[model samples]
Target: MAMIKTYRRDDDGVLHYREAWSEKSGVRTHMGAVGTKGRTRFHSTRSRTWPDKPTATEFLDNFTEESAADGYFPVPDDDHGWLVLQCWTFTADLSHPDDQRLFEHGQDALDEHLGWRGVGHYDGNDLGGKPPAGYDLDGTVMNLFCKVVDTGLGVKVVRSFARAFHLTPYHVIATREPGDDNDYVLAWSPRKRDKDFDLFRL
Candidate 1:
């Protein structure tokens, strides 16, 4: 079972908890801060001495709930998956007058302008290579793929991209991966399929 263990710092008597769990690779632990005498909430990772053990435990419960709501889970012991910081899925309407530039200029123009590489639909070619037939940017609905900066900057990046391209981000989600740091791959597509290389889910 996953648990949060509390500890008091020897130097300052500050209380903190180490949230850890068993994963396929090994145990994964994350630290939480329980502030000093007057501060009851665990705001961020900072040194704080709790008055007693019960206070630390109470804060642990709150931290666990917040972590869960943020889509953080114990690294699975079996399926080798990488954590997804944030994913934004949206379709650009090529018919829109303002968005018609995406269809007129094609993906090559976008790639050159935004420094984005093209990922083929049939084959996993995502290095600015040519996409497979019928997957070009000539369709009425074009998919936009933007590399997420990080969890903290994901939403801002997505929204900025959407505004620049006159598109809308319909879906956004964050995930935790247990496998390699480079395992999470990003790709754009108009049609959704199970075999698509970019379709990763927890």
Candidate 2:
């Protein structure tokens, strides 16, 4: 699960958000999600207002829904723009005081984004009890992860398993990185099936 630093605005309709991350020393750096929310004034170029205090799923849904009112994620943007479903796949011992909350928001922000999109859909005995309080969810896996990403992005995560075409709930996984069977990262893309590099508009 890739941790995403989503950008948001303040209550006054000023964009302000911060990404909570864990560093190598287990220390964290809560950088502004949009950077310098203070210096920028409200009479600004952009203003984001989030009512209902929507969760992650709701956040993405609201964006798409609002766009649909105008009509759809906004072209290659909604459909093809970088969904960037991010996460960190590190083996950290958060039991340390400093590290405790360093990566703590990882789950919070993650659950918020995915839940708001009505994703986090889980139905299996493997669930390790219910999600703790103050959080929108608890469990984590590939399939459940997909529901959140695909719903938010409005596109299908295509994978193998011919009979089960839409089986790739996790379009992108935090595998140190996504690569071919040989574990090569340089040659990856949505067009995994072909070599048609149209993203640059050649």
Candidate 3:
């Protein structure tokens, strides 16, 4: 696998990311917001930008340096964990049995819901079409796009789940998969789903 370099920046609460890597004959980059698939471009080794560098790796390293100087800091290599789209209910305090039971009930409800699973797709190749403002496409990250097989059942389940938890209806959370540092909410729906979720909303 080619070595990939990732970087992130925060602009007035919005998080954006960019990725660069070397290919056999070129260098590629993707830049956009944290969740959505962003735009991608390839710079062929035969281009003028490549003649000075001995290899694609060298060219990419030089490009990364320029990006860093422009305020994009490298994201830790271990940060490439999967993000999951699921239902979330509040648990005031896990140590309290009442909170535990409420949380368990929500979990059970989510697991028992029918037609809950959907076909998840990720960007494996550069795709065309304008992504909404502030979005990027990178093959290295776990950015998921879902299509529910049964939309009728899916919407009903979502509504029920929200009501059961006494949360504002018609919302869902895209959070870090079970055990990755913390249960960071990457994004949320029926609100500002296109933007990264606020990390300090505790």
Candidate 4:
């Protein structure tokens, strides 16, 4: 999945938004007033004159820096008073080599983003008979973390975060079981079969 970032600025009380993301062809950006149709442009790494940015990821990283320097700030996660969910992933089940690769890829893709929180492990045994809070059954693994930025988009952020691991939305587990809509979990398993990715209900 492509990684996206949104920036905002106010000029004389008028608000504008700018969004940038890494795409298959290169870097894409959109900018306009908050409620209007935006203008977009694409830049190819080789075709553009960005001397220091040779990769889409590098281009996006620099784009973010330049946006900040230009007085454009990241849109506030709770701008609309939405409950900002602090979400984290369970460690990937690393019994399969593919799972390890997916976990690493997701981590690397998200670690630098502003929404990324810190990662740590919970002592599953210490949770008083509760299972470890992660994808891996083993409780000792480190969890990757992120927040539900743009909660108004309703899970888009979470889905993109999961897609980085080659996992789909079905792999997401919420912090609350059954009916409660809460945080997210990225599920994984050593079993390669699709059925093994089923959401585990606590």
Candidate 5:
């Protein structure tokens, strides 16, 4: 059997997939890059980088299978317009017995808020649609597009979602617009939780 490895260049962070096999002489033969990076459905043509670790692993897995059959795998080229968001819930908190319920509530809130705006559901593992290739949501991650303008407004939207789901502001993992590397925390809460809740009547 062949051993496959996926790696990114330290200088440019471009991912490469390669396969290796050991010979009888204790020498390892490494195959060339299996797939050519291309524009994915969830990314732009110029951005060939993997959005997350899971996505990179997914690409490697698919490339391994296809390379075995055809000697090469074609990278997908489409942008699904969805951004991945990592969510954390205090499942062990005694006060939050129904963590799953809270999660569902958050999903519902987000859906209701963004559904009519062309956004999709809070998919648990998959992207809920044909997410190009190699772009799937993690177990605790959800995907959506923020068509809600700036990051400040995005934070307000997140706060509203948290309130609707009866969750603290910390539950939302702050993220930026896909492809941006700035310190734009999309999810934010007020300094004084109690005061903010009172002010917003949440």
Candidate 6:
């Protein structure tokens, strides 16, 4: 519990006061150094509490928040009726009653993004490819990637990299049994249904 202060050496060789934050209120207050001599001056960032932990979904939608802070998004689009501008991250307003639309439109935007070019793309790019420009890698990108696919495809893509992407089973978790794992309960298996299984590789 030491006091916070900024000290600058004066021409007289004595350290002079510059700034300090009191224990109460915790706001940064600056001191005037005008006319007073100091070799250099610097201001420390104000101390802040660790941000609240967000649910997985909240963390993923950060791109939208960042975009909104930059003066777009939360704007209304003409055809789509939401502020649907393209950015390194999406800026979707979840104010509507229909939340699933976020997933639907978000996927459409991500699909058209240059990063996912070519129809042949698969697990690796979705999991390992460069994130949208200017954005650092974090769960946000993966979450958005997860939403890019329609439900059937999304379930499959999410499976291939369950370990690599560090994804959990989520809704599928409670239903899964110890000996088996399948995102789609009806997905065909050779041993389970011999005649329906494809014998040759496509």
In terms of TM-score, the best-performing candidate is 3
Supply the global lDDT for candidate 3. Answer: 0.44
Q: List the residue pairs that clash in candidate 1.
A: 14-48, 14-49, 82-177, 83-176, 83-177
Candidates 1 and 3 compared: the better one by lDDT is 3
Runs with alpha carbons beyond 4 Å of true place in candidate 2: 1-92, 95-98, 117-146, 149-202
What ranking emerges by TM-score with the best candidate at the front? 3, 4, 5, 1, 2, 6
Q: Least lDDT summed over 10 consecutive residues: which range in candidate 1?
A: 117-126
Model 6 segments more than 4 A misplaced: 1-146, 168-202
lDDT of 1 by residue, 3-84 (tens): 5433323356433333544343234444543221121222322224533333333445665676666544432334322222
**Candidate 4 has what TM-score?**
0.37
- For every candidate, C-alpha RMSD to the true structure in Å: 16.1, 17.9, 17.0, 11.7, 17.9, 23.6
- Report the lDDT tens digits of candidate 4 across residue range 1-202: 4655554546576555566777775787877654344577978874456555468777777877887877777644444212212222232344454445545554555443213321111111111121334343432233333343333222444344455445532233222222235333323333344232112233
Model 4 spans > 4 angstroms off: 46-53, 82-202
Pairing residues by index, what is the TM-score of model 3?
0.40
Residue 42's lDDT within candidate 6 is 28
**lDDT of model 4 at position 160:** 46
Q: What's the lDDT of the predicted structure labeled candidate 6? A: 0.27
Give the lDDT of residue 72 in candidate 1: 41
Please provide TM-scores, in order, for all candidate models, with all chains considered together.
0.23, 0.21, 0.40, 0.37, 0.32, 0.16
lDDT of 2 by residue, 71-188 (tens): 2222122221122222111122335433243244433444443333322211211111222223332223211122222322212221121113322221232111222232212123
- Model 4, 89: alpha-carbon shift in Å? 37
